[model samples]
Target chain A: MTTDFRSNVAQALKQDAVQTHFRTVVDRLRAHRQAALAGDAAFEQLRNRCAAIRADAIRRLPQLLEQFESKAQRNGIQVHWAETTLQANRIVLDIMQRHRATFLVKGKSMVSEEMGVNAFLQSHGIDCLETDLGEFIVQLAGEKPAHIIVPAIHKNRREIAHLMHGHFSELPYSEDIETLAQSARHFMRDKFHAASVGLTGVNFMVAETGTLCLVENEGNGRMCSTVPPVHIAVTGIEKVIARLDDLPPLLNLLTRSATGQPITAYVNMINSPRRPDDKDGPDEVHLILLDNGRSRIAGDPELLKTLHCIRCGACINHCPVYRQIGGHAYGTVIPGPIGAILEPQKQGLDAATGELPQASTLCGACAEVCPVRIPIPAIINRLRWESVRKNQQSQNSRPVVPGAGSRRRPLEAAIWKIWAWCCSHPGIYNRLTKLATRLRNRLPAGMGAWTVARKAPKPARSTLHESLRTMDIDHE
Target chain B: MNDARKAILDRLRLSQYPDSTPVKCDDQNDPVDPVLWPDERIDCFINRMRAVRTEVHDASHDSWLDILHGVCQARSLNNLLVSPHTRRGAMIYAAARRFPALKNYSQSIEDWKSELFTAVDAAVTSAYGGIAETGTVILWPDAREPRTLSLVPPIHIVLLEKNRIYNNLAEAMRIQNWAMIGMPSNVILLSGPSKSADIEQTMTYGVHGPKELIVILM
Candidate 1:
């Protein structure tokens, strides 16, 4: 409920156990990614190809989505479109209502988290269960997913064991990782079978072939989509790829970048509902394409690159700010460099989530390791500008991000205006600097928040012109 | 709902870049170099599979059944879910007395959900092909071998034909003409047994799917 970014960061920094967990897991993930890509000579070219593929998909998103809809329908897969999160949730609810399904089982899907499907369904008198081991652990603890890929990365084994024991009282208390996993597996198997509707997120939607590709190490995704009679897939509109062949390189980059695996345990490609002649599979397949501010993001050429993200969480792994404060501190669905750029755009600049862009130190590690090579730092810089711009309208006739000038303040604007004037006028600038230098020691040691974690700046003893004159250097 | 679709499409259409050209990505130019695997394709496949803790057994076309029997005995399996209609499935059925009790996945999931989830100890299915570059097995689940055979059971035993092995996924898809023939309802590229690193980043097997993946590579 707390929307303030600074307080959330401070609160997160105070939790010693959480901070330690973040540092340990992120370091391991970074090392894993490094070792995975160490000997691959063609990694850079592969990144370029993947970037081009995603960029092309975003550029032709409308056409590809239309084509995908037609082809998916041809394959007997029902397609639904939602302009907002509520609409997306309603689509899922409608499907569940049609089947009279009171319980829904879910695979690991960040999109479902974005749609707040669980909370919505439960409020409407339905049971929604998260079946992924990590997600199940987080759900048992009554918490949100901290990390996208590893939902329980913020919790160590002992904490997880405690939570599991509390929920599954029949299972004996044990801190062993494998034992805990088995306990959850035994518990969720019944849920997976009894649930009538299952929902999952699409990793990549191939437009030409009408196929949904999902990559996961655990088979819960397969179970959720295959075991249930009704399967619903939710995804942001940006996940489409132009061709089926584009999947191999993207899949290679995604697994390697996210975890140090040459390939995950399973790469499931679901094309349609079970044919009438088929033995066992989902009887109904529903695809819900949620356009929650994505089209607005696609309106801007530079910001359209945000949609190219594969959600590998590599940027989150490499982010220094995220390593310190962890994911919850950001108070957003996604955290780290990608989230810093993406959430601000998705939620607009005036919203509390607008402060996410400033959370980064502009470290380039994220872009350096991005599988699709999204220039995250550069996008953060653009968002920073967009947040504080004086005019809400952009100069290039492109639509400005919502709440464009909400961060601008009269005092800050006046200070920058004075600084600009001082730099433009030589005589006045020289006089002001000389005057300031003579009284340098009189300046206050504290300069507001700037001096909280840093020393205040003082004018030099002499101007550069004066020093140059004494040293006999040439002057313009 | 149509209004929502129209609104989204209209907003996206406005954002289309003028003079957009079709992106060209040459599949032949893919960077997963074949030189990375200098050894024979089967060797690379076996090595990669073993790296991820997958059990790979070498067998001739005639000896694969013996290997399957040995695997079942070693694990002391009670029952194996299979599609007795496949060629290998037919072979297993013809020599049924030598192996454990077999269960067929011929019934609809709604009718067989309870037994399939509780009673099946392992599953045996025919892999359409294998990828040597990443050591993945391709399963085009159909009317005979349903998608859940490799998924719902604790143990998954695959019968792979040696001749069907390809260098990588792209090669497998291209040579198989997947785009031209169209994709099946479910196509899985399974590399290893089901596992997860979600608990403090610790790797644990059999979280929700097969705990053991035995490949009889012939």
Candidate 2:
């Protein structure tokens, strides 16, 4: 029943424990609802400013990128560009080869996962270690992140105890969170001090200054960037903000939305490395700005706002569908409401992970809680249309499986067809509605799929059409 | 070696002036406060250090010492380590005289590894200055002050002068680089406490960094 960290979509769908954990998270969301709603007005204002900043950056992206490259190069930092995941991985590996790095210490970075940096390094006999505790757990379990922020939210303490026991047989089983944390701390301390190269993700890149912002809750991020001889940061180009002054509002909104904290625990801005008079810091710093289909989203009016996402995972925590299926079902580096829409755009709607768009119920909860106010359900619906288009394109000349082919998902098709029919014939619809109202109590159980989890509301005794007719308001 | 040096500078996009002579110091007053800059100007330069979650208060007053003592007691233990900044060391010592329970261990970064790192509960150093827009404290590295002293300790207390605070990060850098005549290799701007949200996204404090930070303004 437990949600195995390494499980794929098919395996996650069958896990009952994951289902129950999601239900619990959804049930507890009411506790945060009041506070979140109160913060909405302030969040909206911040989102508007953030959008302006990003829009401006996008317009000047190329020039800013060139400036950053120039400045970084002048500061002795090697700047690299990768148009695809393969190229990014190769570039990082190339650096490792140049440094003859045996040990790779990683700070928390979703972009690296998107590029499959760990697998690439490990395959080449490089020892890559995750310094972030949540990432370390999933790394140990050989799994992709389930939640963007809290990667192991679906897990209980006992499950972690079991995982730790299996990994460290000498250690005793303990349900205490602190004890488990200490165990991870002890395991990673030596790895960090010994690493030759460190990989990190950039929260924001300053266009004017060419400074890479490293925001985290722990000091490991600092250590990763400073202790290692070579430090590499992987980031999507959309993370760039135009000016340094714009950082505060983004920082404020990101922290409050992500963990309900007023400010981040650590916001380290490194312009360059140790000076001649300086004591300790990385000898070399490299930044790789990735443009892997982000430009396509920037041009689309409907998808443009998706780029405003700070990846705080606030919407994920509040999503009804996400709380049920968890992050694994989305099958992308980022999961939940945001990922469902973004995955298809970045990887194509016909990509093997097409089922992601269908995961949501159009509950409107994610949109309500999203700090940036991305109409997630609307985007998911668009992705569904895109999926349908792709399916139809591939459907040409394929042999139909007799009557079963036409009848596949018949109940769903029939419901849509009926709704379309009702809209077309108002007179017939009115008559049908009145008849249904009279027979509401006598209806059969399980009248629709909705009945599986919720009871159908009792129909009104009479339709508004009937009242209008009685009042002589309209005859047309 | 000469060829390597030229290659390095060429790669860095810097101009090598072999014929240029080093500017000789004209004033015999003090090289530490070079260029005949006033104490007020130096004070203004020191104002760059600002608090993150906490506010910076000048240590020139008596009540400020009480606040420091209160913070020391609240943290449950205290044996302080400070730089050779006479003003900073004096403030702590005066506070200790009032609150005998508190103890002091003052040493510069040169003596960091052997003297300060092992002995102190809190390592207090003067911030080179602060960037107001970023809420970052700038600490310059010196023989008497290694970067490890600021990082390795669990609690970091920084002494910053009010006049040294800059309006934005750009100004802070412009002033700093101008003061040094060239940008130093290390410039660190810290926003808040040292923390990590890595464990199941549950944030815990003091993860491989200082657990606590206190800034003293003068």
Candidate 3:
């Protein structure tokens, strides 16, 4: 994926419509969030609470998982555990195979994207359909989500109208949003009723009460969870919190920051499969707690904050880099500032992902607007350092020692060493500078892509030491 | 019990460390506006809900049926899906003597979901009440008034009591103690009709759920 990063970014930037779409929508979202926060004095207080909840949950994650599992079991939900994507996919397939599910309806779940659930199910001869309107569009288009919240934000309505027209040839083609959405809704109603199994992603799992909460605008979430007899909710372990009471502020911050709404249209809390006396809802509910490298991250103090992310995509919207290139350029399930640092470890830390850690501009906009206040810039820098360390280790045949090779890092170290030596001794520095000044014209025009938009600096005629020596000793 | 669960939990438990003091978990509910009277809170809720494109109407228990009939008439909707077990649905159902022109369908979604999802024009379900801060109606769905009534139908009419409106979700849930007792399998917080701004960020309502949300504040 990193091999094509440069090309993907260049191609996305070339699309004038994607640029205008992101510019208008991001500007609107930024203003909407600002206006919403300006009216509320408790914004900071609520953010602090949300951060505290995330921190405390991470600290006591094991206990919370145990509590959640016991309570969920008591509530009649079967809990499954998976250590990796393959295991998670296998579990999902086993359930589907047991039920002989021919078709399934799914709510938007990034974890499913991480596990490639749709592709895996299709390989096993089961058709898994995405029910979220944005997800539905992207699925039909055979593309990944362009953005976290708005999956098809990169594609204009005309493209979607064309896509829909292609899918249902009998339906009249109209670029009108009403027609597109109406067609989708009418088409989805049949899938919702016919699918015997339902799959969904969870927003928050409350350990105290044993409930999985889902927030969305369209009622697809409700339909997928309620319409099927067998419902499966797969989520990362980091999503669990201590109690249900911790949700209000997080909910406030999440909705306001994500789409700049007071609340999303629907927040569904499912405590269990339908009780025996219940007239609606699934007969059996399966909750899959997926580890998939998250538990390893939980141990590291610096990387643990990645788990704090609520998947709100606030940082992505505010990111200038993301606005320019869009999410597809990131080439991962998640994108934007979060993806820059996260994709490496989530996908696999190889030469392919080494460039991803360098994707960010180290701007602090992501941290400022982050609902959970995850320090994204610091994480990116750490990932960059880790990538450098990995590169160094791969080059050497000798066994690596911790913190032993910083002074021997080759090119970067040699440059820094020369720099430190020059700063200390003025004699050689002045002589070297004079030589550099004489040979300034022979210097290269610019280095790589940096020269594209701006001119390179030319060497100065004299060093600071020479200038100071030539000046009067006492101007006063 | 899976070995993966034990293995992951073991690793996590060993690696767990909290540098900053942990945030204590407590029930400190936010009061959006405590000084306001109950009636004022209801007014606040209506304004916020209306801001989000939800239609609100003030009504008494006895007058709600007429208001509902007018809503049905306005949309030219003849068939309504209602649950006989729910209070609001039963109250409106009991008012069949006065409004025989409106048809009310009372059947479990689990049994007749396919027919209801297609044939029903609107669904009127009872609310567990509303949150004034966010302008959301809370529905603790049981056997009657299942989630489908609010989710599938094009029109979702909610019956929220004026006195039942609370400050926010925290206050409402704490007061109700839903996690401890009287916990329903599902709790739904519907702020407005189903909407999507996914296509070029243009807001469009009623994509999958009800397109119109009408609230009768009794």
Fraction of the true interface contacts (Cα pairs closer than 8 Å across chains) found in each model: 0.92, 0.32, 0.80
If the candidates were sorted by their DockQ against the true structure, best first, what order would they fall in? 1, 3, 2
Backbone clashes, candidate 2: 23
For model 3, residues B92-190, the per-residue Cα lDDT tens digits are 667765443433444445568667777878888889989998899999887666667778878888888888899888888888887678578889999
Better of 1 and 2 by DockQ: 1
Best by DockQ: 1
Instruction: List runs of model 2 lying over 4 Å from the truth.
Output: A1-43, A169-173, A389-471, B1-122, B128-147, B162-193, B196-203, B212-218
Best by TM-score: 1
Task: Report the C-alpha lDDT of model 1 over A253-306, residue by residue, as the tens digit.
Answer: 999899888899999999999898887779999999999999999998888889
> What does candidate 2's lDDT look like per residue over A1-476, in tens digits?
22222245456668898788765654443344345447355456566665566655554555566676676677677777776777788889999999999879998898998899998888998877888777777877878777777666666667778888899988888867667877776676667656889999988877666678777766777778876778998998677776665665667667667766544556667677655545566778888766666655655556656776888777888887676667776768998889877766787654545556767889888888676567888988766765543133364543211111221355766887898999799988988899988998887777565685688677888888887888998866
TM-score, each model?
A: 0.97, 0.73, 0.93
Q: Provide all candidates' interface root-mean-square deviations.
A: 1.2, 12.3, 1.8
Between 2 and 3, whose TM-score is larger?
Answer: 3
Give the candidate order by descending TM-score. 1, 3, 2
- Of 2 and 3, the candidate ranking higher by DockQ: 3
DockQ of each: 0.83, 0.16, 0.69
- lDDT, model 2: 0.65
lDDT of each: 0.90, 0.65, 0.83
Candidate with the greatest lDDT versus the true structure: 1
- Residue-level lDDT of model 2, residues B1-218, one tens digit each, is 23322332232222222343422212232112112234544343334323233435556545666766766677765466554445756666655554424333333333344343345577666778765544567776453455565676678877676667665444565566532343344445565556654443444556666767777666
